[model samples]
Target chain A: MSDLSPVPASAVVRVDLPQQPYSIAIAAGLLDRLSVQFQDVGLTGKQVLLVSNPVVFKHYGDRAIAALEAANCKVTTAILPAGERYKTLRSVSKLYDVALKARLERSAVFLALGGGVIGDMTGFAAATWLRGVRVVQVPTSLLAMVDAAIGGKTGVNHPRGKNLIGAFHQPSAVAIDPDVLRTLPAREWRAGMAEVIKYGIIWDRELFERLEAAERLDRLRDVDADLLHHILTHSCRAKAEVVAKDEREGGLRAILNYGHTIGHAVESLTGYRSVNHGEAVAIGMVAAGRLAVKLELWNAEDCDRQTRSIEKAGLPTHIPLALDPDEILAALQADKKVKAGKVRFILPQHIGAVTIADSVPRDRLREVILGAMGNG
Target chain B: MSDLSPVPASAVVRVDLPQQPYSIAIAAGLLDRLSVQFQDVGLTGKQVLLVSNPVVFKHYGDRAIAALEAANCKVTTAILPAGERYKTLRSVSKLYDVALKARLERSAVFLALGGGVIGDMTGFAAATWLRGVRVVQVPTSLLAMVDAAIGGKTGVNHPRGKNLIGAFHQPSAVAIDPDVLRTLPAREWRAGMAEVIKYGIIWDRELFERLEAAERLDRLRDVDADLLHHILTHSCRAKAEVVAKDEREGGLRAILNYGHTIGHAVESLTGYRSVNHGEAVAIGMVAAGRLAVKLELWNAEDCDRQTRSIEKAGLPTHIPLALDPDEILAALQADKKVKAGKVRFILPQHIGAVTIADSVPRDRLREVILGAMGNG
Candidate 1:
């Protein structure tokens, strides 16, 4: 991304929820000094249940525990097997066992130290553990740091759908260390970029234009630290602001589901194996873009521009050829977001804005999905 | 028990939290008119997932379904195996399957139609399902109607502890039909009385005196209709008031756990099979009374009075002689209420009052348990 004005000295966004407001701290070495960051959010000398996947744990778990121990916390690490398939109640039940063995009190903190899956599961555990304890999120992946880790939406998936079982328990604080991205896989880097592109299209036009200016938006190495700093702050700010307005998704928050309706279906239908969450979201956004244009809700030119950004991020801009259109339609009905048996869609009216459309014609949905298939 | 003042015209206690305030309606034949009652609370034409145990399902499930269907709700029944042993995350997972198959939306309702175990698991399922949905508690047992059903405390037990995994999800409405108690087993009837006695000890002196006025508090049939109505209203009122002031058990709510501290340990040590929740609470209250008297926080006479109430209810006033006192003490350290490694006990200051004691000395606790052993 193009260089912007001087990055703020303090890159923290406050999610001012009515209850349990928290801050997201973004810096390069935040992970190393986690204990200090935890204290900043009022967690200290408490039992900490640090949950992370094996991959992330292997890289940063020791440092995270060390930092927490520095603050006099009794740290217990639960290294869950990495991947979406492992994100279930069974994994969360294991966390409960760890929490009980550690004798974690209601004042104790659950520190989620990985990607969206880790954050979601850990947060769900904290939310339900003793009717809820404090949770501190140290998001390792870009998707988690900017979005999943910031908002209080934490849950595990049901066999039938994505994130079907969860709660709105906000973290005490969200600590983000961009340095962790170096260990993230290339595919994961691109998948995260998809969510970054999502914030650009749905909330911030300046963010969209800046990503368009970048020479390469595919890899973390392609962007310098300043742009990375800008991306993190802008995206976190957008998400924080939206969540502050609607913590429980009662209203207004539905716009954040711009691509998630079909995205979730795609992920669920694939059994969360072939297509990851971000990739599915990217595909869903493309289909939504085409549908918006067909309904004359948005100009085709803006839709193409959005497509260009997704492509530049090296994300899929079309549905996988193997996923049946009819099945995808059926999966959408099973989505947790369905209200009064109506499938709701969040469609971009233009860059930096989206609207919730509840009655998208089934035929238009079918046509757009078929048209957006890979190699169509 | 002696009759209350004209049964208060209408036995409805309002749990007025800042958000999602709901009413607990207590009356005879309330279960038969559940559809109308659900409609009163603004739940109509919604998808309903009715959760119950097999025993309760056999007696009242059809009528419950008929009432819900009459209100134009699409109802699905999930009959779980009865007993505390089945109160685990695995049961909640089955509910998730049922919820998914029924396509329950955010606006949909989960109606819990049994005792505490059913309500706890169903409420937990509702709490996490799609992040959260509305739950309507139809408590069949006296225990659930007074305590478990009114408060939002919903959870499944961890293998290690009671209610170690749970959430505070306030129900949309709690409909109690005292008429259902006719089908309740004598032990269950006595168990429910234990909680009613709890209300007397912790907050309502008049309630305690009323039970003392009764010649028989051991069976539902032994009590007259007016006294039954008073028990439901007064107990619900006490729970509702405490929960409204302290929804998350931050302070005042801990008083509600008056007998639960030691009671949970007894239930856990006995594998939740030997001593049920109410019976355990009865035993716990007995132990708590002795501990309070020994510490000089409460007088022996009032402690004996509390014991007499438990005896009148046909509830156990002493720990099982078969259990080890040392092991019971060890289990206390693992309770969810333990803060900073200190086992907090709610000790009675006097009848109708209790105080939270954080540092109950280990030796003293051991002596109290040993002294309270049955036939000691």
Candidate 2:
């Protein structure tokens, strides 16, 4: 995969918002070639609001801004602090202030040039300012290029809840430049691989099998820009297809939240500071897999394959910090998915297949969470 | 329009959210029949957090609570003070505290049971609580039923800006019973008529003609159940259809804020204490129309028709008391629709036509505004 012999572009993932159908261009040099996606979306170089954070600015933000500017897109930049904790109304106020200060027109496109936090906050600001505007996703990180950039879940987290305030605002185009990931920290790179592996486990077992075979991920690593692009293209297409069918997370979209239930709680428990989102979700995937196995939805071998790939990719597949079962359970009760006081868990029926089970008994859930933590 | 004999079984205008198709039930008994909309939107006889204020509660709170309870919806009512000054983040925080205290779950729906102030505050709370849940719009005043209820534009005003902190969160369902307007004061009802007249001038000339012909809104004023439902049905459908097609308000939605450009500034200048939302927007409509004639987009006769309709509705179509044009213009600069440092105004092309023009010269705009204030 790392042999950069001019990789053939795979199918572009189309998020079919019939009202505003857009393609996610997931490949290396795609950011530099953003005009293609914009052309496909029927938009020309207009005023663009480029949103990124300081860390991402230090990495790929300049490249992104330059690329759009090169494409004749009028661009202005605002760099925010990087972190999930910063995904707040107050934090997003920085971007709103910039847009206001820059005198951005209603038709101006908001180009998100960082990770999921930046993307979510930027998309939301775009959604509300002057009622709404166009958003273009130029995701830099592996996690953002695939998961965050593809779906249109734009929001800011409340002090009491993750993504407590949000809107389902779709982007006009997504420019996923995998080349930017070369500068990513090793931990974040590995963490992002967890979501890459997640796409395979939840939808395409073939992809998972390929990942399992690639024990040493350097072949699949960000250093190899073309190979990295291929990975993002595949992952983004899978996510985009799902989002297309259900833009508002009514049905198929929930499948995408496979490991996020427990993952969200873990991040919240640790104040979203200790572990990356993907790493926390990696642990969540393992826990959900265990629950599925206990419920006879999957066999031991399938679970073992998950374990190997997760660990091999250098991602955690177990819970941490001896958290109280009651606290986790309480958070579960407070979960946005909790309906009728019942916890909703997305469990794997088998590798590449999942279901939203809303009736899982609390005691049984507590056992699965405790068992997963003990395994660590 | 008042001589209606047999009204349909339901006058409700339903918004078909593919996954959750909820209704804007416009029957006289809708406030009493809240369960129908709730159940249709997948909100069963679940817990309801009713957010209202003392003014509404002192009048109809007990009956509203009883009506909801009779339907087996576990109702927890939070009565706040009735004042525009109370529409703040601090108020929203209090609302969140109330929802937290009631332990609102995902299935639970918040019933906004008062006027615009209550609806805005409660809807903002619903938009942010536990990352959002179902919000049932039971707007009591004429302003809310026609303007705010169906739009799904919910938020709390920031000190620095109005509606700066908000989200486009659609209510699970809107239960608009025009019966509630019977108890509303004439001043409040006239304020709502401004929106009604504005909508007519923009969308339906026939509606405009009807208002122009009505010497006294006896049909509307007497609160004749059948006639009132007919009136609300058209209003709700007009707003809902616009919203459904453009949920986030990219372009077509801008038409709905026809008079709000200057209207909002008028409110801000007065500290929200003197001018009501509808009255301010009414005056703003006159101001915008004057600019329209100046820009040669609208005729003087069309302006007279609109101004006369507003006056007949018992609404203010002229700028009120001692407001300096420069101060108002500064406030207008801070208007949410001021993009690229230019205020985007929705001006009428003719009596029945509206176009969003962002290129109005500032000096010319200030001239029209000052002239309307009788101090140019």
Candidate 3:
């Protein structure tokens, strides 16, 4: 333990779920020290199944294996195809085949070493394989690092919906190496900034002000080191705190889905092609802000500030021009967020305060979406 | 709730899992009253996916649907192919498609209306669909009525193994109608007796003695009503108690895998053909008893009593002649119970008592297998 480099105290966020509490470690170059992080979290499994995508594996797969093997772990790699299209039960079934062939015992650990797609598939595979096995998330993408990986919401997308099949199987530990974000696509970086900006508007006003003061919020290279660290930690901390309060999205966790209701609908309506998760979330946040203002739930000035932050992050603040407004509304009904024929929306009352509104009028919602797309 | 006939208090076993406690209602004709049972169990979901096999669905599908519809549930049926071979992720994926098409919400209920295969697949589908939904197990076969349906151990089989892809998602309720056993194959009736006999040997000496006293145990018709009721309630009570104490099989739950260790190896070696689950368990119990006696943990007379009871039930008590003893030993290594390369065995200490043994001698196990096959 002494020979291994210690992770900074501030970099680790502990998610205190009642049944299965775990820590999320965020640091640069933490991927190379994956074994130490596993050990720190008390995961002593000798058999490790490292699940990743080809693109991420090409860059950090060898280092991840070397670190695991340093602790005498027997590592098996399953490199899935890179993209949301391949995230299905067929892919998870392939992991099950690999896991079964490798004779992975219940004590075996699953290490997810990629972005949200790989992390979700691997985690779902781990969740259902032998009922469940321990998983350690090594999220390389900013979106996964700050949000997806910390929440323990793992699943694959269905043809009709995204993340329609899943489980709330928490990982034993999460090791986030911000350094790997350097290789992420530029579009994804801006997409991830959308979530960072979301944390500011939903839970942390100080974090919002910090991002508002930044000169550039679009690219990883453009951001200063201090704010980057703050963005990662603060977002993760906010997610962790909410998840701890409501691990299954029963109550408090719904607030975390502030933009996801419409965001998911936009992603679905576009077939998840043009608008990625973060970009859709950005557009949804804009729509939600306008709806709040229109309904007198929040001030127009606050709504404008929210839109300006999304613009600064280079995220879309309007529905895609090609999609029909009615189709988006229909897609919203099919979303996982809907309950008993009512569309539940998370509308903000202030910069850092939001409330769940199940009775949001349909006409008002349609008008806000149309206005965002310049059709109102 | 008032108009429906009350379930006999003696027939219902409440599985008091800390987070998700539920009830198991075992009655003679409960299949026709499934809705009443669901309402009693607090499952008020309006959308239901009724999963069954061709055989069970042919017998009672309409009745089950009519019962749910009586309670205003919009039930959609998915009739999967019958048998263990079809218990794969592909089968589950089909259910996912049906669920998506039905637009089943998180508040939806998945009612499994067949044997272990249907129950397992439906429960697993419910466990993973939309992260999870409520599931009601209406197990038809005797094997399912007493064992599979009551426990929340839901899963599908991988090509290489049984129940490799699964989860521990407890059903909202388990409704076991003993009358469904009337259409069950005679072989299946005897197979379920094996589990009933198991409950006797492991937890209830009285139940074991009652089975020993039965004039005929090969078919459900020959078994007297009082003893049959005792078998259903007692077995479920034992299972529910064990699962409540150890929900995830941490310690106490492993006891439920008593004959399953060797039983699974035998089933896997033969490709789950010729010898069904209960028959294999019967043979495994004989091996475990002899091994316990050889190790001075149990008496020869008690071992003989167990073998005689298995014979009465018309179940195999010896390893098949075609399977190599060496291959059986190898298969045990791949069993889910293996940890740190050691195969864990649940051996009987006495009637109504058992203990887990991890350090059983390999040579002794081989000799027991050889002796059971008349090769010693």
Candidate 4:
């Protein structure tokens, strides 16, 4: 790991969509300076609805409220239940009630102040409330700050599949306070590292080397603050660049889903209980790496390096033994990316390179699942 | 009215949104030629989920199916209950189930084949199903052909208000077969004229003069096919031009809500049973006309002419006596346009001009409502 240094005052990454352009502010203590950050982005003296889960609100709600109030903004709060299970249209309906009760106008902003679940639900609510409104994402978890918070993909889950219902609603701004990560659960912290490793494999070779060099990544305290800041900045820049090229996921953005196709199947088959998103992605990446090598899309050496990087981040690189391979295959067929019953895989070509493969044979997919489970 | 002339082979009005631009195809017997239309829009040989209401499906489902199958497209169907009351998130959830059961892919097309309710729900389903898919709107009712199906505004109603939940998803193509209007109910036909009158008062003076020249607009037979075609073309063109200028309702598009502010209130206060959308819009237009005259925004003569034009369409020009004025005021406050509890209204400046008014005194709003009810 690199030597310790002060985290920069703040870094700005812009999401340059022609219709709704916004910036993300990454800093160490942004929550305390949120009023100025919002003001800098032209959000001031407005009615702001701050949405958070009970767990997140208990930790950071007061600071959020005080900051907005300090900027002469009228603040209203809606505390939702915590959990991925609570990310639903029903939960979003509750937010509408809050906005309506508060008489939030079109100009009012919705601030999501939690992890990915809260960010997704709040963003969907903001998108549908009065057709659309401004949303400012205050992502507290590493997964959200690095992935969910950077993109405009906002939605709730259906019993049939994850994010089966949502809108591509860009936020007015994204505020990431790395200090909030101190309270994130250990499992979630490790889970987020999987995505960071994903960016390294698919877009940034240097980031991949950095992960390889780090001695410890299992916990927040294991890594120095400067290293953490670099990870966040590099990962966000990779995402921002990809999103800028394809705001609606027409083409290039699909690479960001290198492991998500299989990862989603694993998550669904486990009922989203056995493995969290980051953990599932970690496992999916290992399978995808093997698939790439077998298909000759990438050499075996690069694939092995990819697997080692995932391991270095304290994430699992194998499928759970309890989940059936057949069920995973069925879930894959039902995935959103399956066009005409054919699954599309985002396979890596080498470090910092990937390609979308729409013609993966079903037998290969089945074999990979079973192989990853150690039953091949 | 002008002499009866053959309805042009087809009238195509393009909604020129830079991100997702599409065309509205207005033609006679277009349902039989659905295959060709879908191909013209680059949506051929795809898996299609056709959504319609039981009432509408009973009328045109077989023909629509035959046409798509002729194009070599695989088709599935889901029929929903017909009515504004059924336009809810629960109804949309039913669509998600249908899409999942059919294993509809991201590249699949969701075709909405009914009036406003069916189109809104289906478009929303397409928007959220797998984050988004291609949606081709087949509008059956006159209200849909001219207004609801043209703009990308797709949503369902909330218990609190109408269209309180939705996304702005532009259709890949809007196929309007005017022949289907032959089976439309008399009330719905009359209801559609209210929106036609709205376009006249807001943007097109020639349309206003044409409506005044027509002897009657009570039913499909009352107006010749030529005049009806002209009405659809002009109204749709007006909408397309306005939407092209402002796709997101930022500023120029608010003028499109000329009579909708008070119209929504009347619909909500009446529980959406006593009056349909177009009828409420008719009454709201009369009230807006009166308010415009009283505010000296337009002369009383012009306002009277506007009322006469609405009356010529065989629609009501006054709020129902049973609906209380105070409740109307309360509903107005709850309208999506209400910013900080102040109601913003689109008031007519002249026959072909309007301006958004955000500072109307409360007493004047009340007086206009009472005066339009014949109780001033």
Ten-residue stretch with the least lDDT total in model 4 chain B: B1-10
- Model 3 C-alpha lDDT per residue in residues A90-144, reported as the tens digit of each score: 8998999899889999999998999899999999999998999989899889999
- Residue range A256-312, candidate 4, lDDT tens digits: 998898899888877778799999898989999898888889999989988887777
lDDT of 4 at A99: 84
lDDT of 2 by residue, A1-376 (tens): 4455566454467788766788766565676677667667755677888888888887766666676776678888888888899998777777777876676666688988888999998998887665577898887777887788877888887677677667778888887766677677787777788898889888877677767666476324423444455567678878978888888776788888888889888878878887679988899899888888888888988888888888888888777756776788788777676667777788887788888888987777889888877444
Error of 3 at B18 (Å): 1.3
Best by TM-score: 1
Q: Candidate 2 on B1-376: residue-level lDDT in tens?
A: 3455575435657675554556777766677677666657666678899988887787777777777777678998888788777777678777766776666775678889998888887887776565567788888998899888777788767565667656767787777766677788888888888888887878777667767776665225554454455557667777777777667677887889998988998887888878888888889899999999999999999998888877777677667657887888888877777665678999999777899998899889978887777321
lDDT score, residue B30, model 3? 82
Among the numbered candidates, top DockQ falls to 1
What number of clashing residue pairs does each candidate have, in the order they appear? Answer: 0, 0, 0, 0
Candidates sorted on DockQ, descending: 1, 3, 4, 2
DockQ for model 2? 0.42
DockQ of candidate 4? 0.78
Model 4: per-residue Cα lDDT over B112-179, one tens digit each: 99999999999988888877898999999989988999878999998879998888889999998888
Relative to the true structure, candidate 4 reaches a TM of 0.97
Query: Each candidate's lDDT (Cα)?
Result: 0.88, 0.77, 0.87, 0.88
- Clashing residue pairs, backbone N/CA/C < 3 A, model 4: none
The segments of candidate 4 whose C-alpha lies over 4 angstroms from its true place after superposition are A1-9, A374-376, B1-9, B374-376
Interface RMSD of each: 0.8, 2.8, 0.7, 1.2
TM-score of chain B of each: 0.97, 0.93, 0.96, 0.97
Off by over 4 Å in 3: A1-10, A374-376, B1-10, B374-376
